[model samples]
Target: MLSKLLIGVGAAALCATATISLADTSDKRIALSNNYAGNSWRQAMLASWEKVTGAAVADGTVAEAPAFTTAENQVTEQAAQIQNMILEGYDAIVINAASPDALNGAVKQACDAGIVVVSFDGIVTEPCAYRIAVDFHAMGKVEVEYLATRLDGGDLLEIRGLAGVFVDDEISAGIHEGVAENPQFKIVGSVHGDWAQDVAQKAVAGILPSLPEISAVVTQGGDGYGAAQAFAAAGRPTPLIVMGNRYDEMLWWKEQKDANGYETMSVSIAPGVGTLAFWVAQMILDGKEVPQDLTVPFLTITQDTLEDSLAATQPGGVANVEYSLEDAMAVVSGG
Candidate 1:
């Protein structure tokens, strides 16, 4: 009988110092079930999956590892996609889900069908599915903690991610928690950036007229530069805006640093964590007794590393690191 496995993971950097022998099952097939692909971050994620899994398929690591994404970022659409992947008889399905609880029913069905289901980023809450989750709460809190060292206290403008998503909720909660603890900073205005530059710009522009002087802007990702743009266009002085790891954001920081000695940090996970999910599925299919969950860490770029990160990043791409099978095994070994 197949053993039911569930794992709870903490946020840590990916470790790959340990090596392990593998079991063989090269005939297995895997599939990626992604919810949305609207923003550059999602676009970069899809590209990473294709590059890594395409190589896996070419090298015969798996028979097929096709990816599917939904046009609308809806739970119903993604559930239907999962059902179809099940009907198609895929051996494993890795998800960047739309909902944590809303997709649990479909996830259960997939697990009951004996398919190895691994979720990352937007993870599911089903007991049978394995999660490779990020410490997004810590991420949000860290942004504030970093800011506390720089400023005494002032009004903050908050830029949120997609509304009603788990990541948005968790990160926002952490930010709020940090604010509560610090008590020095007050959020005077808030808007949903939808994790897009144009959206953030418009939202910030709409709210800027009524708020107090913002000492800083807090963001989810893909919104920092837009926030900066809104401030410039409004003739408001620039504020310390936290950045996501998008290339454009870093590039703008480098430009500002050169012109004004601006200093800030960038925090985000690479889109390449999907590749780690791919290897987890492959290891499971190979009959390796791997751990159920993986800890996905966030990447932070300080002022000193901004130029190097910008150089490493493609014009429209985000800072990224693709994991190898060895990295996956190290995660399994708890290294």
Candidate 2:
């Protein structure tokens, strides 16, 4: 059941139509508040949120806003934004927490003020509200296991995301657990990519010479692109295996493979995550009871599964049975 719910939420993130009308203004106000807006994927998510949920807003509408991506990637301003929403008496609040524990106090305050609160992507500790998130642990383990089967015995390098972020921690934990079980694979070093492509690329460029024998590389987010660029620049064999998070990066990998005849994998799970986050907020706003933790099932796309473009166009970016939004509302309302 938890899996099903996560799937439902994931589907919402991947496919959303942006024709919602905001003609209605009532007491049932909702806020779509986000932590960071700097990345391409995050921008895409904001667009989807406005598009898919806009249609039903004639009687009530959600106010969309964002917090800047600070030098520390902090959400202090975002927390204050929620406090303002509470003072304004918004009916519900939907958030993507920048830090796991830091948002707990603010979330508790919003909940105390009678606002329905929920989180997405990164969730807070003790879970003051429900969450919609991808299974980072599962994602890390699955990707690493794939790399292990392909590389046999070799040196590996990892480019990770924002330091101390829960998603980063979850993926790292999963990778460590998977790697610990395998003796042939040794992780030589890891540099914080901060989920940025350029940061990852720079990190890899500096580390490549020092670890020339590296055979496999796995990255948490945008840094995957950097790893590929480093391999290209160094004129080295593409890591026997590599995996990354966004679909566009997969497209780049496909291009690299086609042009150079080098194989790579893209295990993208971002689009569906937006869907999951949005629905989780909706469910909570409607007063539905959701599981404390849920993992959206994903696929590790290689050359073979790369041609399913049309199917990939569907909601969640992974094919699945379509569920009606009415059902979600029904579940939330306990009708």
Candidate 3:
């Protein structure tokens, strides 16, 4: 009777362990490579990711597998890291590729090695895996339309992000589409800000004296703040219409509004990209089918839309609306 009881107890224990293992695949680890942590949006995104997945890391309780931040914004570094992940036999890889095409070879290598790769935020035009992104073209066109309504026929200074990026290219195309529809709006000067605050400030400062006819500035969110600083320094009396930048720097925008009397607009792209990346990772781990393209909704936030806009910013400062693993799974399955 005692021997029979011992055997039964051992069998139950083994079954429970196996069931727990099957429920959460946290043991299936993944690596995340962000394009760079060079801005407020990226920082906010990193914090959000930690908040969502930190508990699992702390308790070593991955319902799926391990996920970690492996590299930041270097194309070469990303390639090396992906190679390492392949060697380590990770189940999935989530990357925010710095360049649209530069990471293609590395991505192909990952696929060749039978590892799952999903790129988000920025895309690799070459199809090695899944892609999740914001509709940058729509974002740009929407922003330009807003600017067009604010101005009739004024000289506009445009601030651009990194050159040759898909986001930049697509957004530029959208802006052109909007601008072409309104011929009265003239582009006085267009400068590359590289999406950096200091870079934008310097770029706009240099152009201000030469193109003083600037009626309003159209630019990336980061460049929007820089344009405001430039306008203040140059004593330019023009309003700025921009995409999401200075997300946590609302005080700065309010101060600028009071002092410079210029208005700004932005879309929360970071959270969208983060949530998408997490979903792609989940799909890869589940051995599920992933769509070639996944686009998240982008919201425009202005002083008028402040209340609605603030509602979307996650409590942890994440850019997108908060969602769970289950929600992400739903999206993956549906897509």
Quick one: best TM-score, which candidate?
1
Error of 1 at 106 (Å): 4.3
TM-score per candidate: 0.79, 0.69, 0.70
Q: What is the number of residue pairs that collide in model 2? A: 9
Off by over 4 Å in 3: 1-28, 34-42, 55-77, 98-114, 125-128, 149-153, 162-169, 209-213, 247-249, 256-263, 284-289, 304-335
lDDT of 2 at 156: 82
Off by over 4 Å in 2: 1-29, 56-80, 87-89, 98-106, 162-169, 246-248, 259-261, 268-272, 284-288, 296-300, 304-335
**lDDT of model 3 at position 101:** 85
Better of 2 and 3 by TM-score: 3
| Candidate 2 lDDT tens digits, 1-335 | 34534543444443343223221223345666677766566666666665555543542433442222333456788788778877776666777777778878889988666566767666666455766556788787876788766777778888888998777898888888888888778899888888777888888888888885778887775667677788789988777545554554656666777788767666656443544455555554443445655554454666776656423543323222112355444433432
lDDT of 2 at 255: 74
Q: Is candidate 1 or candidate 3 better by lDDT?
A: 1
By TM-score, rank the candidates, best first.
1, 3, 2
Q: How accurate is candidate 3 locally (lDDT)?
A: 0.66
What lDDT score is found at residue 90 in candidate 2?
63
